[model samples]
Target: MANYNPYENMLQTLDLAADTLGIPRNDYEVLRHPEREMNVAIPVQMDDGHVEVFTGYRCQHSSVLGASKGGLRFHPDADENEVRALGAWMTIKNAIAHLPYGGGKGGIKVDPKKLSERELERLTRGFVRKIAPIIGVERDVPAPDVNTNPQIMSWIVDEYSALTGQWTPGIVTGKPLAIGGSLGRNEATGRGCMFTLLSYLEKQGTSIKDLTIAVQGFGNVGSVGALLMHREGAKIVAIGDVHGSLYNANGIDVEKAYEYANSHGRSLEGYEEPGMTRIPNPDLLLLDVDVLYLAALENQVNEANMKEVKAKLILEGANGPLTKDADLYFFEKGIPVLPDVLANGGGVVVSYYEWVQNKAGFYWSEEEVNEKLAKNMKKSFEEVWAMQEEFKVYPRLAAYMVALRRLVEALKIKGYNG
Candidate 1:
């Protein structure tokens, strides 16, 4: 992999996109840095009477468009730099989707799987209590990511509301539907990714059924992405998760894998079928698939493995999956990569819808949510595609340019410079 740091790698792309747009340093220099960063120490009482202190971070990258929006991740590898980069990505993602919001991100350093259910609940509440001062229905909104889910968001809503003595579900998104969660929010990211890919293919006169897809990290994003592609008649040749990966040339039943992971507590360990062969995680990246879906961690497609990636297109289901060097390598190879900002913007789009519904006391049906998502994703893909064609640059850079241009225009309209 590349030796470059994740934050620095993101900066490299940002600088290039800024240069491509010819934006002056004075115009977006502030965008290069976060608006605020809060680091908190969360102490949780374990069932064994042990007090373990965990480090947590909340970074607001920008609020020029509107309130900051992003997700909170619980992982052993969560760090300030990763949180910062992810926060910045949320800004770009929202702008690319044409949402009226900037970007923020939160994370806690813990292996969530190691904690008991009670301990997990306690930790979630503790995080909300610590960040309560800065987050709210109109401030920074937090969603789910990585080890976080709707349950965690429900805890956040309950803690924040109990502290303030009001029922404010808008303070968080991705909650359970029984609460104030939006319909179609769970599958929004993957569905958005597929929609963008489909739009791109349509412009190129290609179809999904003609593609062979290999997906990495079969979590919420990957599993859903593979299933959607399969539904569209694509051949899902390989898939993987945190445990490992599996491949089959004829196609590895995505429906079977999805059911297996669901029943087996979100795992793919014992998945099997005829013609299926288990492969290493990295091997999934090098597979000779038409489209490679990356829904795992960042820096997965770094310099070390860039040369081995044989896919014609890369759909980033994870933020910052390809390092700067790897991104450049793909550009040199003429491989089209739909950057995470545009590829995985579905979650934030629906999150915005949820916020709107909460504010207006009206909700949309699942069909309405999916239809609106498709419309926005199609428009974004077309804009980015046009920028790519006009600038003769990579898709990621083009996407950044599209988002940056919109952000700069918004800043100008708001008279921020004055």
Candidate 2:
């Protein structure tokens, strides 16, 4: 996994999808690289009165479809390649969901947890100022990922608005409700995962109630997805995060786990129930279960342990959870893997809605937001499934095919100018 390059992984899938569609590489070669990438050095004053410089990157993989949109993560491992790959995946995800947006992703190389509140705010503002020139209501919008959230997004909106001298809430999504954020934006990604999984199960003439699931990652996406799945009557056999993992074949209380993680800095290190047994973080992927919901980091199930995975179904709630080889191993084994472009697209989809509402200066109720989300998720998954059937390929490839076709069509319509 140390040698795993996410951008290269993205290219592998992109090439295969284009090949599957019988499109020449030259004609669609523009999609092979980012339209633009900006790197910034943000220096902020620390609480101890010293200054620390941080590296940030914003990669726009495409603008041919429409405006660029994706998340801005603050992780210790955030880098240009990862951001670029995530940006490309955003393009695919948005196209899969039929959103009128391209793909862009940005992140800073720092563990946001290590920063004091004031320091973090200053660093965020500095980063925003550097990238503000290129982002806008209809250009590029960023949402939260990893250690960032609504509060962080609010800070971005405030900083960007301050710099622009105009009130522009659409410059970013995932803001607070009082600031034009959509009603269902917080749980959009996880809810989309649930919606796609349920749609798949329904088509198989089964229900989530009959499954025993293991969830890796207890953050907003993983925990929300697990809790929602639990509410649907699935037995959550195991759950874990960076600190540790826990297993209880009889089923763990997902709601309690959600609350506990929320109250404990988003770590599942010390929570224990009567039947729960502690396990290593890596072991969570190998657990014998009906479902493996990976809402964690990238390249988790790579070539090293792909053969040991026992999950009958894999739902990707995170971008690029499975390496290319792991994806092939499962596809050849006949297991249905719900790709991220289709499963976790609810975030970008709702971000699109939020951007629209921000521009329109109108808001919808939570019911309306959720209704629109569920309908889009179900329809997107069905479209991907149909593409999979038509192509006789893996769902991931099918999803990439769906997205790449849209990108190519857009390119043709726009011509090769600028």
Name the top lDDT candidate: 2
TM-scores of the models, in the order given: 0.98, 0.98
lDDT of 2: 0.91
Backbone clashes, each candidate: 0, 0
Off by over 4 Å in 1: 1-3
Location of the lowest summed lDDT over 10 successive residues in candidate 2: 409-418
List per-prediction Cα lDDT, in the order shown: 0.91, 0.91
**Residue by residue across 1-418, what tens digits does model 1's lDDT show?**
4345677767778888888889876777778889999999999999999999999999999999989999999999899998999999999999998888989999999999899989999999998999999997778999999989999999999999999999998999998998889999999999999998999898889989999999998889999988998999999999999898999999989999999998887789888888999988889999998999999988888768899889999999999898877888888888888889999999999999999998888999999999999999999999999999999999889989999999888888877673
Candidate 2 lDDT, 140-167, residue by residue in tens? 9999998999989999999998888988
Task: State the TM-score for model 1.
Answer: 0.98
